[model samples]
Target: MFIQFLKENRYVSMLLTLLRFYLGWQWLTAGWGKISSGKFDASGFMYGAVKNMSGEHPAVQPWWGNFLKEVALPYVDFFNVIVPWGEFLVGLGLILGIFTSFSILMGLTMNFAYMFSGTTSTNPLMVLLGMFILVAGINAGKIGLDRWTIPFLRRLLFKKTEKEQFPQSA
Candidate 1:
């Protein structure tokens, strides 16, 4: 019942639109800040995360810390490029309601990654809100571009018109 309401309710959709805007702005600002700074470095952060695995009840888990040290540190340059741009793109997607599900998923991925690195900040809240948007599915983007894009894509990909899918009553 609750899930159906979330998925189909017009009022809930409006609330989701507001939530999307808020999250989009948060991501856009954070990404823009990093991009404009021209000195966003992940190596230091990686080192800190790796070091965090040492203490008892370490903030960062050993597996994640190892991944950070071994994979991420070696590819710090890649992270440097992808992190800011990924955030920016996710924000843009969410705001535009194009690829809304993908945007939320990417945002959640980043949020989890940050949390794993021991940086809580606003990540938890973002994750909670993001989950709501994700669960809402297509309804979350109904007021945005997905209203058209999804249907167009469905027609293009499935090669089925709505009339065929739902025959009109004579």
Candidate 2:
């Protein structure tokens, strides 16, 4: 029932758009800080993530921690480039409502990854908002560019040519 309301109502969509803006701002600032830095690095964060494995109630699963240390740490330099730009792009996508669900999904994925690394800052709140927006589906972006963009893309990419082949009857 609530989901239906969110899908159909304008007020709910407006509220979700506000949430999207807030979340987008958070992502944009975080990424912009890293990108603007002369030499942004993820080695420290990766090291800390690996270190989380030692605690009794480790934030990361042992297997996942091992993967991070063995696989991720080795490529910290690459992550250093990817993470910042990815965050900025995700923020831009969400703020513009271009593929909003995809943006929310990516944001939620990052939020979960942060939680798994034991950094419990605003990640949980962001996750909740991302989930809410995801559940809202197409309506979530109705107030943003998706208003026209989605429909246009759908018509172009998923256009039903067969349906249009039928001529009008007299």
Model 1 per-residue lDDT tens digits across residues 1-170: 88889899999999999999999989988898899999999899989889998887999999999999889999999999999999998898889988898899999999999999989999999999999999999999998999999999997898967799899999
Compared with the true structure, what per-residue lDDT tens digits does model 2 show for residues 1-170? 98899788899999999999999999988989989994888788878888888877888778878878998889888888889998998899889988999988988988888888879999999998888899999999998999998999988998767657786777
In model 1, the Cα lDDT at residue 134 comes to 95
lDDT of 2 at 41: 84
Q: How close is every model to the real structure, measured as TM-score?
A: 0.92, 0.91
lDDT of 2 at 32: 91
Model 2 regions more than 4 Å off? 162-170
What does the lDDT come to for candidate 1? Answer: 0.93
Model 1 stretches astray by more than 4 angstroms: 160-170
User: How well does candidate 1 match the true structure, expressed as C-alpha RMSD?
Assistant: 4.2
Q: In model 1, state the lDDT of residue 158.
A: 88
Score candidate 2 by TM-score against the native: 0.91
| Span of 10 residues, lowest total lDDT, candidate 1 | 153-162
